[model samples]
Structure formats: C-alpha cells, structure tokens
Target: MNLALWIAAGLLAAVALAGGITKTFVPKEKLARANGGGWTATASVGFVKTLGVLEILAAVGLILPAVLGIAPALVPVTAVCWVLLMIGAMITHLRHNEAKFIVLNLFYLALAAFVAWGRLGPEPF
Candidate 1:
C-alpha cells in the first residue's frame, strides 16, 4: 500500500508538472489553437497562469516533503489540494460540454483522492 501511494503520487506529480509548465509558458492563443477547446477560452490569462503556478507548487508538495523525510504530513495535504483542483477542472469541462475531458479529470481526481486517503491513513511516511 505504501508503494502504491508512492507510485500514484509520482504519477500525479509528473502530470501536474507537465500541465503547469505548458500552461505557464505557452501562449494563450497557441494553447487554444492547439487544443481547440473552450476551457482555456473561458478563463483569463492571469487565471490560467495562477492555476499553473499552483499546480507546479502542488506537484512539488506531493513529492518533496515526503521524500526528504521532513514534514511528511504535507503529502496528504497536497493531495487534498489536487483533489480540489481536479474537481474544479471537471466542473469547468462539464460547462463546456466536454464530457470526454471530464472523464480524464475524474481519473486524476480519483488518484489524488486515493493518495490523500492512503497517506493520511495507512501509508503515512
């Protein structure tokens, strides 16, 4: 169970990092064109960039505290934050009628929730 939690956290960290980097660096127009979606269009540049920064911070929080054996409790806390982020993402995607996207977001949400539960309960490290 501990190993499973680590694997899930690692996967989430990788995804969040990639998403953060893309959202932070890519031009808004380019992203819209690349994805051809209303999700980004519905949000302001500042808002998207802010989300990106938060995601990056969350990604770091998911790994660093636990790995370094310092303030390990932060792992579950960070997972909770990821859950909130995914919930918001799902809501936004649903508003855009992007059911397919919501499916992926839900998967991410579930993984984050699992990590939160595992780290807080059985897999404290």
Candidate 2:
C-alpha cells in the first residue's frame, strides 16, 4: 500500500508538473487554439495561470513534505486538493462537451483519491 501510494503520488506529481509548466508559460490563446477552443478558450488568462500555479504547488506538497518528514500530513491534504482540482477539470470539460478530457480528468482524480485514501487511512508516511 505504501509503495502504491508513492507510485500514485509520483505519477500525479509528474502530470501536474507538466500541466502546470504548460499552462503557466503558454499563452491562453495558443492553448485554446491547440485544443480547438476548449475550456481554455473561455477561461481568463489569470484564472488559468492561477490554476497552473496551484497545480505546481500541489505537486510539490505531495512529495516534499512526506520526503522531508516535515508535516507529512500535507501529503494527504495535497492529494485531497488534487481530487478537487480534477473534479473542477471534469466539470469544465463537461461544460465544453469535451468527453476525452473528462476521461483523463477522471483518471487523475482516481489516482489522487487513491493517494488520499491510502495516506489518510492505512499508508501514512
């Protein structure tokens, strides 16, 4: 269970880091164009960037606190945050009728929820 939680957290961190970097640095218009006017098309640039920063912070919180043995409780908290973020992503994708993105969001949400459940229940670091 511990190994599973670590793997899930690591994968989630990698995905969040990549997404954060892209959303933080890429222009919103370009992102929208690339996605064929998906949710990014309707979202404000500031909102998008803020979400990216939050993702980056969540990724860090998922790993660093547990690894450093400092406030390890934050790992589960971050996982919970990721779950919420993915829920929001799913809602936004659904609003845009983007079925594919919603699937991906669901996948991420599952991983985040698994991490949260494990850390908070049987696999505390």
RMSD of each: 0.8, 0.7
Per-residue error at 23 for model 1, in Å?
A: 0.5
Model 1: per-residue Cα lDDT over 12-100, one tens digit each: 99999999999999987788777776788767899989988998998999999998999999999999999999999999888888899
lDDT of each: 0.91, 0.94
TM-score of each: 0.97, 0.97
- Candidate with top lDDT is 2
lDDT of 2 by residue, 28-123 (tens): 999999999999999999999999999899889999999999999999999999999999999998999999999999999999999999999987
Clashing pairs in 2: none
lDDT of 1: 0.91
